[model samples]
Target chain A: MAISIVVTSGKGGVGKTTTTANLGTGLALQEKKVCLIDMDIGLRNLDVVLGLENRIIYDIIDVIEGRAKLHQALIKDKRFDDKLYLLPAAQHADKTAINGEQVKAIIDELRSDFDYILIDCPAGIESGFQNAIAGADEAIVVATPEISAVRDADRVIGLLEKAEMAPPKLVINRIRSKMMQDGEVLDIDEITTHLAIELLGIVVDDDTVIRSSNQGEPVILDPKNQAAQGYRNIVRRILGETVPLMTIHEEKKSFFAKLFGKKK
Target chain B: MSTKNVKLKGTKEGYTIVLHDVASFEEILIDLEELLLNISKQNNASTEISVHVDTENRLLSDEQLAKVYQLVEQHSTMKIGKVQTNVLTKEAATLWKESENVATLVTTVRNGQVVTMPGDVMLLGSIHQGGTLKAAGNIYLFGELKGIVHAGYLGDEDKVVFAKFNHDAQVRIGEQVQIIEGKGKNEPLEDTTFAYVNDLHILSFDQLDQIRAIKPKLGNQTGGLL
Candidate 1:
């Protein structure tokens, strides 16, 4: 039986799609058959993040609307042989084009075939949220250290509890440890306190996330990247391994190390 | 005139017996009967009194409305008309009211979400920055209130907005709005706080006992929306 998890954030631009993409890729690294479903119809980007945007022929809406079969619409990850696949969302279709029941049924069909199904949920607590959360065994709420993002995450946590999605885990993404130490933004503990949910993992602020995304590659594929280390730890933790959170040490450049640093 | 707080609205069909939401159905019925009796003694105007028992969230059952219709027939020479209601509001209202209470909010009100309630709201959780909670009655918060809250929505300035702890929350009581600035984590603003519309200004008190010491001054206690 596959464990379906929906990655959601009540607020927009809080790295929910990124978390979904990275976590799905991280799970596939464990040799698990993982399928990433982009549920953010009309605003789809998960396929692009996984570097499989050009391989898509049909979308989630097409599958639900009977235009295409589930397997026919699924795009296997360009990098992974048989470990990872992606069901891209329809850009032209509205969020309601696929109802919760339809999404749930589709997810149920995919359950027996995969080890993990990660649904990249759209922002806001609306029909899209309801649809994305349906049929998911668990939820992962992504948030940043900012007050606004944390506040929205708190609301999302409350909503997930209402939906009764197995006590949603929290992912504090894009956290600036320097800012937290300076008391400029909320720390990890403060965010957990505000949201009142179990801490799943924390992704420290890293520039490599954007660079990897521009190349249509998930940052988790980069072994040396701090954010990738964060995601790998999360994947281990999900596999019931007690992995410590990645320490966001200050990026110090020694005089000789900087002088002899490898050119990009 | 609404004699003894019994309101009669002139509808296109005839007159509607507007019931007070706060008062019991029986109390409203007695007041309506008294008003009809007084009207009959004054002049023989052929007026009808069809009860508008359709309320938001909770509507009177057919049997319950039948009792009112039969009671009005026995008390006065008024014909009952068909009752209509906003069923959507009634369903949404009753469902929330029944499942939870004024003090227990099942979910945190997020930004861009407007929570307009029928009665007093007791939010057991925090409110987001752009989130709003408007009610026809008072608002009591046991958690942080960092959002906008407008209490006394129906123009009852006597209503108050209270927080379990002090924070940078903007509260409105009818026309009066007050914001306690700075971090509520320390200093003069420490401890729980409550605010009410007193005179033309909004009065905020830090201690619960402080409410008893201050004599409320008169002010405009009507018409404010957020």
Candidate 2:
């Protein structure tokens, strides 16, 4: 049976889609069959982030409305060699087009084939959010190291707690190390403690994440990248592996030390 | 010739008309009417006497109480001041019991969650930022407070919030609110600290031991002398 997880952030622009895309691809790299379902509906971007936009002929709405079969709506990622697939959201229909029962039915149908089903939930606590979480066995709450994002994540976590699913894990995304060290922004400990949930992983703020997303490729495709390492660590943790959190300070120290040593 | 079913006594505030619980409603009404007429005639017509009606251990219906008021109004110099009863209805008893209690909760108050209490609250879990805990009376917190707490939510200014201060959270006592930004020139709040509305009507933070000097009623509840 597949473990379905919903990636959600109550506030917009906190990298829920990016986390979903990377984690889905990361699982595929581990030889696990994964399906990335974009629940953002009219504002779908998971297909674009995974570079499978041109390949999507049918979407989740089409399948939910009985216009297409479940297998026909799933867009296979060419890079994963049949290991990764995406059920894109309908760009034409609003979030109200689908309900919780329909999403649960679709997830139940895909359970036998996929090893993991990651639903990319939309922002806010609306019907779309409810539908996305209805079929999820677990949830990943994404939040940036900012007050507003953390506050919204806290609200989402509270909602998830009320749901029948297991306690949702937290992913602190877009962490700026310098700002955190200088106390300009909230630190990881502060955000985690305030949210009061188990911390899954932390992704460092890197411009390459944005560049790679614009290129229609998830940053996790680059194994050596710091942000990619963060996502990979989270994927390993999800697979029940005990991996130590990546040290951002250690990574920063080596690069500067090498340059200063060369100058001496 | 009729036995007295009602007696009028002088009190410091005014006169009190005590109705006999064992007497029939008709007998009490008849006796009360005759006694009020006599008192009205004895007093000068210019002076008005407002008397309290005390029904000892008697529960009167609304119509019965209204009848008593109507009888008192018949006399020109007499008027009803207040009505007193010793018995309570089930609903009123439940409400009264709730307002005198202190609820103890052990669960975490998460963001967007609001915990409201009829009286005081003693919470054992943390309140996350964006969460709120409010009470109609005082609040006694034993856990970490990172959210907003409103004590005396129904506007009873004497209520206080007793807890260790987290500098970032906000405290509200009645109409006064203090956002503890840790920026005030006053000494930093330590453990066993509390926030209350002071005599100046400003929200002030102080040590818990000083609660006796600030709100003596809170101390008087637990065998402390008034």
TM per prediction: 0.69, 0.78
**A248 in model 1: Cα distance from truth in Å?**
1.7
What's model 2's lDDT at A248?
66
lDDT of 2: 0.89
For model 1, what is the C-alpha lDDT against the true structure?
0.79
Q: Tell me the tens digit of each residue's lDDT in model 1 across A58-96.
A: 998889888899999989885777999999999998987
The complex in candidate 1 yields a DockQ of 0.17
Question: Model 2, range A1-264, lDDT digits (tens) per residue?
Answer: 999999999999999999999999999999999998999999999998998899989999889889899999999998989999999999999999999999999999999999999999999998999999999999999999998998899889889988968999999999988888787898888888777789999999999999999999999999789999999999999999999987766334467678787542
Q: State the lDDT at A113 in candidate 2.
A: 98
Clashes of 2: 0
List the pairs of residues colliding in candidate 1: B57-B90, B57-B94, B102-B122
Regions of model 2 farther than 4 Å from truth:
A181-183, A251-264, B1-93, B107-113, B144-146, B182-189, B220-226
